[model samples]
Target: MLLSFRGAQHLRSWPYFYYRQKSHFDSAILLSNPRNLSQFSRAQPISARAMSTGRGALIVFEGGDRCGKTTQTQLLVQSLQSMGLKAELWRFPDRTTPTGKMIDSYLSSRSEVDDAAIHLLFSANRWEKRAAMLRALREGTTLVVDRYSYSGVAFTASKGIPSLSISWCKAPEEGLPAPDLLLYLELGAEDAAARGGFGSERYETLDMQQAVRRQFESLRDGSWTVVDAARPRDAVHEEVKAHAVEAVRRCAEGLEPLRALWSREPLA
Candidate 1:
């Protein structure tokens, strides 16, 4: 099932887009990377309705660039599918949507946007699809989102622009779906640079990534699980799978209704 949506304007005004377009990825698309996903060869019957309320877990993977989040997200999704679990992968700056197109232009340096404006655009990219996302979750499909509100706050607040305070950056994202488990694929900025170096995008530089890392660190609390991203892919997969399974169980066992980011009670 193609997860991408169209007509951002229509998606905003109509809630039907959420219920009408519910779909999942085909096995071929889910298991294309045998090298990484081939490790899981057995299928266990883990129901899509893992949560007590029959909703799927919202698992988010966050980290600096070059931390292998994309690869890991794919592998984890494959693993879940291999076990007969209903799982899907979603990424931010979905790039396919209209608002996402604007974000893409700014990230690739094709166009310039004010910092605050671009930040909200990123949030809007997610907002336009909230209903669709909620449908999947409520229908018992675990969502492994590539990036979430953390990235919004981290990258934008990293700029240190006085007007674009962390609070301001986080405000727009308050009502988005909160993750059941927030995993930070922890990697140092220097190590990330050594992996393959930065990309040509706006915040892909070492300096910017370093600053983003600091912002991510500040948001760390009990809800976050800091994984050692430097570990071998298989090793990291092992760790991610364990945490994901537990998080799924938690969500299935009856989680509270989704709330705003950072609005839950403070961490001890």
Candidate 2:
């Protein structure tokens, strides 16, 4: 179902946007990326011309493995671009990067790292991309991302590590851009496993996936819209498209400053 514009506005004001004071770690990590430093050094006040053109919204897709996040993100980006909106598709553990290579090795079982260490690496991978992400939104390019911070937190926390509690996992993720809309593709574990190429990934086991799903549930707030992915692909796409279109319209009307991830008091 289409989310009305008023509904979208209400979702935007959800408790997730409540600002939190950045911790020392948050400040240090944000400055670790040289691109971020450069951008800050060159930043200027928004000109009248720039303010006239609104920024793009950050739209994220999150789900357990084999839940069709990749498929849906591509479809949504294509739809938005076809309608002449500036849109791009991005995914995490972006194994192409230097940090991502380490994450890829661990995920592929080619190497081993401590659970906490790997979790930090996943967060670092996203930090590396922060400057570019901010620039794109400010330049009016909507980002349709697959498996963002929610996946990172949910997957690692699912490990049930004593030290890696939900709050611990969320710590490193703070200060990253928050999604304007979070579309979660919900599917049964058995159904997801039945889909092709499920077992190939490291976290595809049924037990692990079940735990991850629970973590996702805990992370859900007003910003999330759950899409039943078991439905036909076209039907699922229509709902995603509707929400995305409304989000884009909301952004164009007057772009809100990008909020930090998990920066606010979550809904009770």
Candidate 3:
């Protein structure tokens, strides 16, 4: 299903986005390389449902630019599908939209703009996708987001703006749909540099990225797990799968509703 809601105003408040109670399901999918997601094969029954709503859980894989988040997210999607769960993965800055096009220009240095202006544009990009994201959540499909509001705040604040704390930066995204589980891949900036630095995009610098890592650690709530990304992909996927399974179970148990994760509160 597709939802068409647009405009700059935020639709929900922080409390609504961050706190709420919901059940979690216990299931998992494992993955290999990006294209070779067939490394593992297994189909579990949709045999598990919390309250018979049969809704698929929402999970997000978030981290710095070169943290292998894409690979991990794909693996998770494959694993969920293998288990008979309907899952979908989405990447932010969806360059497909008009707002996203603007963001893309800024990221690629094709356009010159203030740091703060671009920051809000990123937030707007997420906002534009708000309706569709919520629809996915309600449609019994496992939603795996490669990046979400978390990246918006962390990356922007890392830009060294004064008076821009995590809370301040994230206020705009408050009230946005909350994820049942947020996997924060942990890796040193140096390792990320070794893997690949900024890919000709704004906010991909080593120093800025290091700062964003710090910001992410601070904004993290209870539903997040920080896994080591300094090892092999298989090892990282193993760790992600274990925690992901537990998180799904927690969501099934009616874990606290995320009061809300995103907001459009005016920057204070």
Candidate 4:
């Protein structure tokens, strides 16, 4: 069954029956099979306080360098789209933006930036997309994001800069949209070194990667789903797909108002 929002005039094409709730937003819960109607009937209508009638799940992929986060994000987005769900792929350091261009220059070693400044630039890169990201989710476009604030914190804090504590690293990211599912692609340091094109970028060295991994471990919480990326690609994709599908289902039913990341507590 699919959950979507549609105007009354546009609901005639499908054989499915939907329970319509009229609000400031026209929200419709569509059940493909009539039998499911009873189940949906017993379910509570989505709260009016939600961002919209329905919002897409934010699924984030995070891990050390060369841990297959990029590959997994693409595959997961493809899988969701193939299932007829709305999904889009997003990534951090969106290098096309002006702020991102500076970050790109620093990461590529063409220019040097202060460690503290570079860290904030990374966070700013995401801050620039905050509005659009929220809009996509509210419009039912599930986002499969590669890297995020977690990467900013993990990579920057791994630098061991005296001023950049874990809590300080997390501060700028406080108000960003939190992911419904955070998938951490776990790979050993040795395995990550063996991956092709290792050390091609600023943070790809073994020592740096190891440090980043330690930082990620410290940041992990109960909300994270750790996947063993050493397995074959398809095997990892199956585990990711299962979690993503469940997250989407939960969001479609009703998502709490978008929450701020690390708003209430400092990272340990």
Candidate 5:
């Protein structure tokens, strides 16, 4: 059944239904279909106090370089916070940490490292912050990450590094949090390149971006929501906001514990 954003909000008042984490931020809200709710020994309305014991949603923005992930990530965070939801913005290869510093150097061409090593470093950058990431989610703070393992594995694997296969690149990130909704800012290489051109980062080339796009395509499944990012900024934000609001609704029943990236099944 189609669930509206308001329908999810009303779940709190409707006492008959409750939600449980099916996996990660993906909660199985037993709304409209209450037959299977027998598993939940008790049915409690999902109020703020109830949410405090659970976690928040993990929303990720992924796309090729110059696809406006950073901008959209920030804007979505603002929107969520405006709605009184606890939301924060995070970026991968966070240049602030020690491992991130190395990743920054690698991206800026200031340092040279083996392909496999650098790929691991990028994954490590996320690992170092995994605890805090989990804490934020568990404490009812939604995380709007600018990038994630998808970018790491996609970008590195796009480079055709013989040793750094997709599976190998994903090994380090196996136990990290998985995004409940992966919004892929859909934009073609040429369109993305047209936007202020490419940056000086290592993977800013058109060829690399195309290959990364291919990788992203290969990684997509039901978890992904492709939004056409080639539209005007405001237009894109509208669509993103819609998706973000819906995600908050679906997860409003309270978040699930963070799970490993593609841990339950192999990533296609």
Candidate 6:
């Protein structure tokens, strides 16, 4: 027996008949031996409201420097569009805003910057983009963000700020937005060093980046995947796409906008 879904689980009106032997989520059933669904089954249509909760998945890719975040983000965005889905790509520290310019200067070593100031600035960058990000998700746009609040915390914490624990650093972004899927691209310090020389900027030192990588790892939990950046870009991309697609399927059932960054939860 086999079943194929005719429409969306709750949004589309259809009679799903799961085969006693084999079936798919499509709600259609095929049987090696015939079984009558209409005659001996309860087929009822469910409303769209009851199918799922939450909105599109908020996916963030964060890691140490030069982790192929931009390339992979573009791939995901283009792939999603090829699949006829509405997808948007956003990169943090947008570099278009005044605050972002300051950050760019600090990163380029063109200007002196206070560590604490840069930390908050990074947080502010995300905060500035928060509403747009949320609106995109609410409108059923799958958002692919490269670097987010995680970068703020991880990068800042790596700089030896006494009070800048990950949690402490993230407090300013508590109401920004939470990512449902976070992919932390992992690469060895030596590998990263060999790929390219660090930019002539503050925090671009090898030791600093290694420490930043450590901080990134410390923040890793079930919420993220440590992709081996040492692999070929395509191979890493395949792994990321597979995991991301599964996550998207699981999240699409709800299709409602989420308020994770603003669910009124106190700072962790």
| Native-to-model Cα distance after best TM-score fit, residue 60 in candidate 4, in Å | 0.4
Query: lDDT winner among the candidates?
Result: 4
Query: Candidate 1 at residue 63, lDDT?
Result: 95
Clashing pairs in 5: none
For model 6, the stretches where C-alpha displacement exceeds 4 angstroms are: 1-54, 255-268
Cα lDDT tens digits for candidate 6, 156-242: 888776877777887888777677678988887767766655555576678988998888878777757778877777767766765
Against the hidden reference, what TM-scores do the models get? 0.79, 0.79, 0.75, 0.79, 0.79, 0.75
The runs of at least 3 residues in candidate 2 whose Cα sits more than 4 Å from the true structure, single-residue gaps closed, are 1-52, 264-268
Off by over 4 Å in 5: 1-54, 255-257, 265-268
Candidate 4: Cα lDDT at 62: 94
lDDT of 4 by residue, 9-51 (tens): 3444555433234534233333344433343433443333332
User: What clash pairs does model 2 have?
Assistant: none
lDDT tens digits, residues 189-243, model 1? 9998887647767888889999999999898888899899998897788778767
Q: Give one digit per residue, the lDDT tens place, for model 3 in 120-187.
A: 78888888988777676555666788998888888878877787766777778776777777889988
Q: Roughly what TM-score does model 5 have, to 2 decimal places?
A: 0.79
Q: How many clashing residue pairs are found in candidate 5?
A: 0
What does each candidate score in C-alpha RMSD? 12.8, 13.9, 13.1, 8.7, 8.6, 9.5
> Taking the candidates one at a time, how many backbone clashes does each contain?
3, 0, 30, 0, 0, 7
